[model samples]
Target chain A: MSKPLILVTNDDGITAPGIRKLISIVNEIGDVIVVAPNSPQSGKGHAITINSTLSFEELNLDGPQRDFSCSGTPVDCVKMALDKILPRKPDLVVSGINHGANSSINVIYSGTMSAAVEAGVEGLQAIGFSLSDLKWDADFDQAEEFIKEIILKTLENPMPKGIVLNVNIPKLPKEDIKGIKVCKQANAKWEESFDERTNPHGTKYYWLTGYFNNMDESEDADETALANGYISIVPVKFDLTAYEYMNELNSVYQ
Target chain B: MSKPLILVTNDDGITAPGIRKLISIVNEIGDVIVVAPNSPQSGKGHAITINSTLSFEELNLDGPQRDFSCSGTPVDCVKMALDKILPRKPDLVVSGINHGANSSINVIYSGTMSAAVEAGVEGLQAIGFSLSDLKWDADFDQAEEFIKEIILKTLENPMPKGIVLNVNIPKLPKEDIKGIKVCKQANAKWEESFDERTNPHGTKYYWLTGYFNNMDESEDADETALANGYISIVPVKFDLTAYEYMNELNSVYQ
Candidate 1:
């Protein structure tokens, strides 16, 4: 049987340690191709380059893998890979061994998940991996075995159509780590407070800063699962339709 | 009581005719403050500027409406407006009288809808308006009365918490247009086929082009309403959680 083809990408530039680890792990399972943004595209949720031109350069990085760096957001990288770089449709698309968590509301602001979402939008099986630690050198060692297990499982039994997996690993050692739990996104948000500062020219500008606040008590939520030391896996879809409210709102409009 | 403070913004840039018309209509409803992108930010879905420095300049062209043009995405404009510009928390936020349709699957790629979603994240009542026509010279006169009615009603009775409206107006004249219908997002998607072309340098590039394909047979979808010449008002929220699937998937993980 032919090996499963895995397409990998990330938002934290092509040289980030996260994607390197991701590429190494996936290489053990299948043929891997890494296409990612040339620079950090944090918080670049689903944005695509429309007004400007796009360029992709093939790279000969120190790895036994195919790689390309694109001058665009994560969504653009996925599109470029699928349209320009890949020889054929990949069996699975995986984004991120990200520097930080994409649990709860963070998934909406995530470039990592956006790539995964874009892949799912193109009718491919996709998954986004995020660790709960932000430090660049945070231990991804613990996530290796589970990552392989999940990838193997996904390749064996494909995900449902239009659904992508958002898998977040809790910051724990392999021995200390609990099993994965399927969960929903917590009703959480960031309280944005811009730090007003003056530029060198004495002109006032602002830096967007925020503290994440998760107040949902729902134990079945991704936030809750992460807080309890389990790796949370949420089945996410790109459609934002509030189907239940349609009938109630339609009556009001009529 | 002082009228509810309403923060107005759009993805079409502060000087776009569509937003100017929106500001004019919103000026009568509340103390309106406009803060939008300095240039067109189409397709910047939920993106926020993190690595770049942002600046803003007061514009004199908001036409009797106080306006600031920010060098950022639609989400950044909303954050800056809330944290730096507005004196206090706004009771409501309205984004766009956008020049093109943000209906069905387009909402995921829309900078217009992202502004409104940002407001909902901040716990403010919000709505995004888009007309079917893409012309810069498109007549917005027909939408005046219904827009006013929707805004007035929204201010009087805010949306259910965490819900924001994605409203798309049909392109018909005022007399020919049917009234609004609250609908769910249609199960529609963009089928991308890149338009490959050669530059003057003989290097080939591609323009991201696609047609909208609606797969849902449901009559109560946004695309169905818009196709039938009725304005569609879809109550959308940022929570992309597939809640129903969580329980069923949990069984697998365990």
Candidate 2:
């Protein structure tokens, strides 16, 4: 039996505490290869570098870990690692320990989830992990056991093709943590209010600011699971086909 | 009755002929305001600018259009337009005469579609328009009538709340075109094959490239509609709740 090859990456640059923690965890489970953006690519969804040339440099940043920092989006890092750097197909790909939550609609805007989604598109078992806390020094000690368990479970029982797990952990002490809950993404959204500002030239511009509004009171929602002190695990599929509305729309088109 | 205020934008910078044609189409229909990226932001999906300052300059380009080239993503341009530029809430938001198709799963990574999705999130009626071809010299004349018809129809009859249209026009003569088909996004995806290359330092990197593989043979799909020379309009909503799978997974979690 061979050791599982684990490809690790994140939206928060390669040296961020989040991916460092992720790399440390995966190192115990499998052969770890880290390819992440040189700078933070937080909200850069599935963006690829079309106009720019991608560059990567192998770093001797840590002990026994192979790391490469790339000048591209999170999706680019995954593509580069899988298609250029890695000698063979990785058994699994994991993104994040992202600084912010990618639990609900934020998944669409998250570079962390996009890395996992990119791997899922390539038929690899993938998972994206995030903490509800956005603090730079946020503790990930509580999530270690569950994350490792989930990764091992995913490796033992592979995920469905094109599906990835989006796991959001609540910020809590290891003992205070509730068990994991498999749930659906809550029907929630970011209610945006752009903060108006003046440029140096006295011209007006805006900065995007928003409050996350979780309107779903459903018992099985990821938001509810997290609020109730449970680690929320949502099996997210990349196929954006609104299957239920198909028949109704087909009738209209016909 | 007062003229409806139409906010226009695109993923292809404000200079693209496609958007110019779109602005011209809507100018006749309503009072139009154009706010788009200064550069192409093709695959930047639902991303927002947080790490950097954004700027928008009113361009003095020669045309009937009032354009502002912004230093941000498509979603940013929309927020800036609504919050800092437009005096009041726009009656409708129309994004793109995109240089490429945003049909099927591509909608998840599309900046053109993101602009419209952002508008829809802000509780405004929005539509994203795309052409099948990616040519800078692609014919825009053939798109006028169909664009007008769809936009007028959309304005006349409101779409469901939180729903935004991801409309893809076949790059054929408008007369040869079959009527509009309200379709669902096909189960289609990009089969990514990265073009690996060695840099000046002899280190290898990868350029992400892929071909679209259609998995759905259903006649009601956007891919099917587009292939049949019909304009495919898939009403896309951002709420990613896989409701049916919730209860089933909840039992396992419990």
Candidate 3:
């Protein structure tokens, strides 16, 4: 049987340790092609470059996988790869061993998960992996075996169309990990407290700063699972419709 | 009783005619404040400017409403408005008399809808309005009464938290247009066909272009409603968890 083909990408720039680690692991499982943004695109959720042109070039990175760096957002990298780079439709598209958690409401703001969602929208099996730690050199090794296991399992069982997995691993040693839990997205949000500052020209500017507020206490909440030392897998869908509220909304419009 | 504090914003930048029309209509309904991007941010879905500092300056536009143009994406405008600009939490947040359609799958890539989703995430009553026409000079006046009615109705009945309205108006004259229909987001996607070309420097570049492929035949779909010349109101939620698939996904993981 032919090996599974995997497309690798991330929100972090092409040189980030997270994507490198992900590429290394996927290489053993599939014929890999890495198409990632040339610049860091954290927090750039689902953004596509419409007003400008996109350019990409092949990179001589040390890897068994072929690497191409593109000047666009993470979602753009996925689109570009599928359109211009990949030889054919990949068996699986995996985005990130991201440096931070995308466990709850953070999923909407995450470039990592957005790439995965974009792939899902394209009718491909995809997953986004994130670690709870947010450091550049974060310990991605801790979740290596778990990531490998998840990928292998997913390859065996293709995800439903319009659905993708958002897998967030806890920042712990492999031995300390409490295994995987499929959970719902927890209700959480960032409370923005912009740091107002003045530039050298004395014009006031603001730095975006905020703290995460987790409000879900349910046992099946992804945040709770992560807090309990389990790797959290949220089966996320791109259909944003609130089907339950349709009847109520109809009355309002009437 | 005090007037409703209506916050107005858009992805088409502050000076667009679409927003000017929106501001004019909103001014008559409430004490309005406009906080929108300084430049067009179309297709910049849910992006926040985390890596860079943001700046906003008050613009003396011809209106009764106070206007501020922020140097960021549509989501940033909402955050900045809530944190620094608005005197209090707004009674309602309305984004876009957008110069394009944001119905169905377009909502995922829409700056207009992202601003509304951001407001919804912050637990505000929010609605994103868009027209099917993509021209800057599109006839926004055609649906003024409908837009006003929708806003008034939403204020009377606040949206449930984590939910917002994605309202797309058909490009028809008010008289020819059928009344509103509460609907589900249609299953549709963009078939990307990159317009590849060479720059002056002989480097290959590509412009993102695509045709909308609406695969939905259901009568209750937002796209179907729009096609029938009726305004479509899709209740959109940000909680992306595919709850129905959790059990199936769990079995795979195990």
Candidate 4:
């Protein structure tokens, strides 16, 4: 029997340890195809390269899966894969196992989740996985069992239209880690600060910096669940319409 | 009496006529401050510049408002403006008088709308206005009155938190226009295609192109309203969590 076709990609460049671990894990369950950015695209959001031309090259990444690294954003990789590279429509599209977190409000600025959401927009069942750690050599070995379970369950039960799961793993050791929890997005924000610097040519420039502030403490929020030592799965959707305010907004036009 | 602080921005660069008109329109009602990209940033989506240094220069645009041109994406401009440029938290953030359509699924790839969404994330009232015409010389005269009305109404009646308006004006003569309609985002998508080309060096490159495919013909859809010659206003939100599917998804983990 043919295996389920899985498309694996990440926001961390193609050679990142995170995607390497993800590819190996998924290879055990499906026929994997790897199409990811050639360079890091950390906070690209749902960006697509419209003005520039794109080029890609084949890679020999010690895997059975056909791999190609493309010069584009994470969302662009998804589009290119669907249109040019994939053998057919993938059964599941999984992104990330990112080097950093993509939970709470971070999802809006996340290239990993944006790739997953782009797949959702194309009517594909997708998931984005991330760890709380920012290290390139972070411990992904601990997430093997739970990640496999979630992927298997998702394959068995397709995600509903317009929805995808954003799964974030706590940075705990294997045995000490608790279970998984389905939760809502936490109300968190980045308290941004700019580090000002002066160039040798007498010009001032700034580097963006910020710290994540998780404001929600509700038991069902992703932040709370992760704080309690469980992996948090938040169902994310692409429809940005605020349906509740539609009626009131209409009244304004009246 | 102090004027309301109105922050103006666009994805089409600070010199685009669309935003110049927007600046003029808002100047009548508020003290305007324009902080936009130094070059055209069309289709940049919600991207932010993380790995690069950002630079901005005060501009001498012919208006009562202060102007600054920044070397960043639309979302970056918003962040930079709020963090360093603006005198205070703007009473309202107005993005675009975008020179093309940002209706239906186009909203996802829109830098113009992303600026407003970023403002919404920062807990500010924001609106993104776009015209269906893509011409640099498109007529903005007809939109003057209606745009002012919407802005004034929005200022008088503050929008709820996390919500921003995406207003798309049809490219019709003002006389033939049928006012405005508050509508939901149409269930539409892009039928993406990549045009392949090979350089003399024999390496293949792809240029992204696509056409909008609107599958929803429902009465209250933004696409439907635009087709009927009416200005379409969709109240968009940044929170991506799908609430209804959370229960069923939780059952899977159980």
TM-score, chain B, predicted structure 2: 0.98
Top candidate by lDDT = 3
Best by DockQ: 3
- lDDT per residue for candidate 1 within B29-62, as digits (tens), equals 7888899999999999989988777888887763
Worst 10 residues of 1 chain B by lDDT: B245-254
Candidate 3 structure lDDT: 0.95
Candidate 3 versus the native: TM-score? Answer: 0.99
Question: What does candidate 2's lDDT look like per residue over B148-188, in tens digits?
Answer: 98888778777676788889999888888988988878877
Task: Compute fnat per model.
Answer: 0.73, 0.48, 0.94, 0.85
Give the Å shift of residue B249 in candidate 1. Answer: 1.6
The runs of at least 3 residues in candidate 3 whose Cα sits more than 4 Å from the true structure, single-residue gaps closed, are none
lDDT of 4 at B125: 96
Off by over 4 Å in 2: A199-205, A247-254, B60-65, B196-206
* Greater-lDDT candidate between 1 and 4: 4
What lDDT does candidate 2 reach at residue B77? 94
| Each model's iRMS | 1.4, 2.4, 0.7, 0.8
Q: Across the candidates, what are chain A's individual TM-scores?
A: 0.98, 0.98, 0.99, 0.98
DockQ, per-model, please? 0.72, 0.51, 0.92, 0.87
- lDDT (Cα, tens digit) per residue for candidate 2, span A125-195: 99999999998899977789989988988887775676788999998898878899888888777776777
Query: What order do you get sorting by TM-score, best first?
Result: 3, 4, 1, 2
Each candidate: chain B TM-score? 0.97, 0.98, 0.99, 0.98
